[model samples]
Target: MAFTFDGPLLLVGAGKMGGALLEGLIAQGLDAGRVRVQDPAPPADIAALLARHGIAAEASVADLTGPPGVIVVAVKPQVMDAVFPPVARLAGARTLVVSIAAGRTLKSFEAHLPAGAAVVRAMPNTPAAIGQGMTVCVPNAHATPAQRQLCEALMSAVGEVAWVEDEASMDAVTAVSGSGPAYVFLLTEALEKAALAAGLDAALARRLARSTVSGAGALLAESALDAAVLRHNVTSPGGTTAAALAVLMADGRFERLLKEAVLAGEGRSRELAK
Candidate 1:
């Protein structure tokens, strides 16, 4: 079901991520007629669904109305400059600007909008497509509590959300959560490869790898136990699980490797900003 926001929504860039959010909103029971979207080639499913609800779809922002209650910027960061200037012109004084463009900041949006414009920057991962996304948002100084509430309500329609007082932490959030799905996918791939190396058929290995990881994650979600406790629960002394743990714990190898990988992601996020 689509979640309802306080008022109308204007979604820019109806690509994969944007389309997923639109579906989530409808699934949450948000009024589809109150939504407007602009995209060059919106997905067939999205276009049909929006049309069914009386929502308008246009090829360019110029065809959309001005000063939406919530204006979501889902366009790619590389094309943000080309996409937002006209939006800025159309933004009303009270319009809340929410951006999900990785590497772009609130200041960038503020620069394009009217003085004292409310801007919220968010980092959402690919998992949003599956409704398991972890998103982090932060508001510019000009944003009021009411505007923050609106942004939070709008983003929550897609997935869980958190806030960081320090804007610098946004880059770290991008490193950890924004790019986290790829890391998890990589782990699943490695597990499948390892299973194949252990003489399992490729198809069986993939099914086992994906199901095991996904099931364990679901269990963790339903449990009160912390991750460490969960790990200990699976590892009996002198058992196979313990044997695997021994290799993973040896010389702090896996921990160090993951730390390095996250640092690399963080660095790359900053580099993209430049």
Candidate 2:
């Protein structure tokens, strides 16, 4: 589906994640004319981007000749309550409120909006900057099927999109894809450290760690085989990969630790909802 800029799109934040979405949307044929930024102090880069696109930025949501078709809530969760009332005013019957703020729920949006407000809660990871994002969204009952399509279209500008019927699943989604990138980075750091300890030069170790992880990820994404199958394929009998797997997978140590980490993240997400 083509994601035409059926704006005026009210983007409430101009931070890194939000800026990435705006840039991606533009690259995918969204018209900058219909976009506005509500950030009071966007970073210099984002301010320049807004100017380059000829999109207006304001301290508040304002001056649109018409009500916004979509109000993308990209502000931090802590500031959501303060931000919603003004947004509520601009969200007409035709409006679709799509929020990317972590831990902010549909019900929270409902409480601040007019009756029968349509809302979607979405979580997108940092990889969205490079158009490799993974976003999971859940819609309130009031959202129309057309609105869902629009949501999917806009999100697809950044990367892949998935939907879930259960909003509760967001906690796990937040734990996994939302925080998962940091885990991958940590793995890269560990690999680099290990390579250094193994007597490789710092620059070479860094290159090996980053390139190997990124290359493997690209392969995994493009491959038809599942990750386990790919892992097995790479492991020749008694080879280096097998030797490494033995230490990493011994007694399911890696799996257990990863599970624990994800669970802890999920628990924190749940707590934030409160």
Total backbone collisions for each predicted model = 9, 0
**Deviation in Å, model 1, residue 48 alpha carbon:** 4.0
Give TM-scores for every candidate, taking all chains together and pairing residue i with residue i: 0.94, 0.97
Q: What is the lDDT of residue 225 in candidate 1?
A: 92
Those runs of model 2 whose alpha carbons end farther than 4 Å from true positions after fitting are: 4-7
lDDT of model 1, residue 46: 68
RMSD of each: 2.0, 1.2
In the range 1-274, model 2's lDDT, one tens digit per residue, is 3663355888999988899999999998887877878999988888898989998678976667778889998989888878777778887877899999999889988988889988999999999999999999999999889999999998988999999999999999999999999999999999999999999999999999999999999999999999999999999999999999999999999999999999999999999983
| Residue clash pairs of candidate 1 | 1-27, 1-28, 1-29, 2-25, 2-26, 2-27, 2-28, 2-29, 3-28
Tens digit per residue, CA lDDT, model 1, 112-229:
8989998899888887888888889999998898888767776776788899877889878988998777888999999999999999999999999999989998898789999999
Model 1 Cα displacement at 133 (Å)? 1.1
Residue 158 lDDT, candidate 1, scale 0-100: 75
